[model samples]
Target: MSSAFRNRRIPTILVALAAISAFCVGCSDSEDESDSTTTTTTRSAEGADALTPFVGTVHFPPVPFAGSDGKNHLVYELSVTNFTSGKTTLDSLQVIDADSGAVIDDLDAAEAHQRLQPAGSRDSADSLEAGESGTIFLHVTLDESVAVPKNVVHKVTTTAEAAPPDLRTSTAEVGPTKIDSRTLPVLSSPLRGERFIAADGCCDASRHTRAILPVNGQTFVAQRYAIDYEQADDQLRIFTGEPTDPKSYFIFGEDVLAAADGTVVGTRNDLPEQVPGTFPSGISLDAADGNYVVLDIGNGFFINYAHMQPGSVRVKLGDKVSTGDVLGLVGNTGNSVAPHLHFHVMDGPSPLASQGLPYLNDKFSITGQVASTADFDRSEGTGIPLVTVPGLQTTEHSDQLVMDQNIVTFG
Candidate 1:
């Protein structure tokens, strides 16, 4: 899949190619009775009063992520909405390669206008106005000696002064996608030998660790690989005496295990805990995941466990839990700012309405690296050190794939 985007044709005014060939024959007749490995294909071009304007989807991440530097990355997401009542301008988005159509990477219009969303403040309007929705956070690394692009192609393009028709283009078709990785366990380290801090791992352009969450009305971007786990030390200090004492921080209650072998499907113990350096007022999104736990752990995955520890939740809702079993401790409650854990792996059990897949951890080691937690929180408030790196560093990350700040340890 690399013939560099063959025969590019861009011009359309009132598209319908037999309604896009009956929407690709009803997506190949429900993808042959659907077993679901995640494949999606779409293409559109409308204007002459039929109106569509832009409309996008992309997703893709069933496999491909061998990267700890060995390459093969992939990671997708395009979203796009703008449905025309007025403003529209995306004008470029590429990614192609669906069997030799090549192109591989292109999203740039000021980083797609800073990854649009809510579009109400950076002085608004980077185009998408009418219905307004935006995501574009792709990745694509490939080349660990080749052979990974089974299917892909997201090629979008737009422009609209009320559909004047200067360019339309749409493409879609995401993948043969299937990289189901989920080997859990090693979950017993909400903090053990000490220094921790992966603060927003996996694809974090920080829309609060990957955004676009709507839920009931649907929109979903569900954390897309969430991971916040915090606690720091060996000089990369996180907090000490009186920051509203959630035990002055060093990972307040700790524990939190059960990274696999599950069945609990939901539990949310009382909810209170939240003081360490503040933040958590008027919270509600059904308590924004404060004292949580979700588990299921079967094929369609489900392992949530966010901001735990109010009563330290043991396991309930159906109770079957195994691998390192403990299930609860670490706290600062919902939408926290301190005692961290907030792990993720979802497809459902409703932790913010699911969909954040990708899991691996069968082992971990990489011992030193705080690189800059805002220069270790300004060297723990001005003792002035900057890039601390304490000791013990072997970097043993097998079947590895954990991003953001990474300073692992677990067995």
Candidate 2:
């Protein structure tokens, strides 16, 4: 296939996550890891901390949010650094409630490796050399019967290749963090329709959840809560004709609505629509969001809408908008690979420099779900019908967040 027509996911880029700080032992770098990249915590003065060879901490204190599955989920990233002088292998990880000493969750080496990824690299994270760092993308779900913990810690077990005979294997309690107590913004749907797909959204999706990037000397996870919304026809078709034409997609020229009451803080409307099917190359950092709108929704939170149709933006800077206001029309613009509405909530107005915030939709229903992200991509690339999972009930959801690969209907 020609390079321009080759299928590539939208907004792909290389990023290096910052090393987390907690149990910094046998430290090599003198600089502090407490910059804007990670959440800073006070180190323990206990004697047992001196024996730990791995440093770890969370990027942000996670807020528990309800999902369409009727479970409370804690979604966040954990960064760890092997501060030992030799190679170290991660054996297991267990999440523990620091206040009650109760174990919340446990993962074996194989499962942990799937969730762990080295900074700026996609290699296996089962082993780490000296000074190597990796981030574990965590998605902990709790049943309605269980109570949410106020604080949590990680019990990490590892083995060092160069350690003395009696000290080769060790376990350490690291990455102490308190749960975020702030309230999540209850959002309205960004579009009103059926067969809407939440692509590259929430929880375990690496395309958005682990998209940590460095900007202006600090690393931030602006896309952590992002969701690319696309629509499909009754036959589960995302596009009917030429894949390269934005007009061929089901969601093309659809109205993009404001998710909340907010004032427009930023606007861009001059960029032309990008051809669908293949990812655009050489997109500058500034134009990656193309023809976008940023809304200041109060309490230091902002709503970002990207990949809008050229000349379709209805709101300008400083214009006050209410829920369900039409901001623009969805189009294949900027760094997009298709015509879809890219929506997210951030702590600041700057798209790339802000931290993502958790949120929930006021009402929606799960009519179905795509079998997987790969299946959705196949339908997008080949113009085949979406591969859906059977036996799923058409369940109604209210005040819950839609997860990745969900086929929802909002009104």
Model 2 lDDT at residue 199: 92
Instruction: Write one digit per residue (lDDT tens) for candidate 1, span 237-259.
Output: 66667777677677778888887
Runs off by more than 4 Å, candidate 1: 1-52, 55-71, 74-81, 85-95, 102-131, 136-199, 204-207, 211-229, 232-247, 251-274, 277-336, 339-395, 398-407
Error of model 2, residue 293, in angstroms: 0.8
Among all windows of ten consecutive residues in candidate 1, which has the lowest summed lDDT? 40-49
Number of the predicted model whose TM-score against the real structure is largest: 2
Error of 2 at 191 (Å): 0.5
Q: Which 10 successive residues of model 2 have the least lDDT summed?
A: 9-18
Cα lDDT computed for each candidate against the true fold? 0.61, 0.82
Which tens-of-lDDT digit does each residue in 1-411 have in candidate 2? 434234341111000001122324434664564431122111222222234557898878887888878898888878888876677888888888788888788989998888888888755578788778888878888989888999999888777664543345667787999999788888999999999999989877778888888788876888888999999999999999888999999999999999999999999998999989888999998899889999998987898999999999998999999999999999888999999999999999999998888789999999998989899999888789999999999999899999898999998
Write down the RMSD of candidate 1 (Cα, Å). Answer: 19.7
Best by lDDT: 2
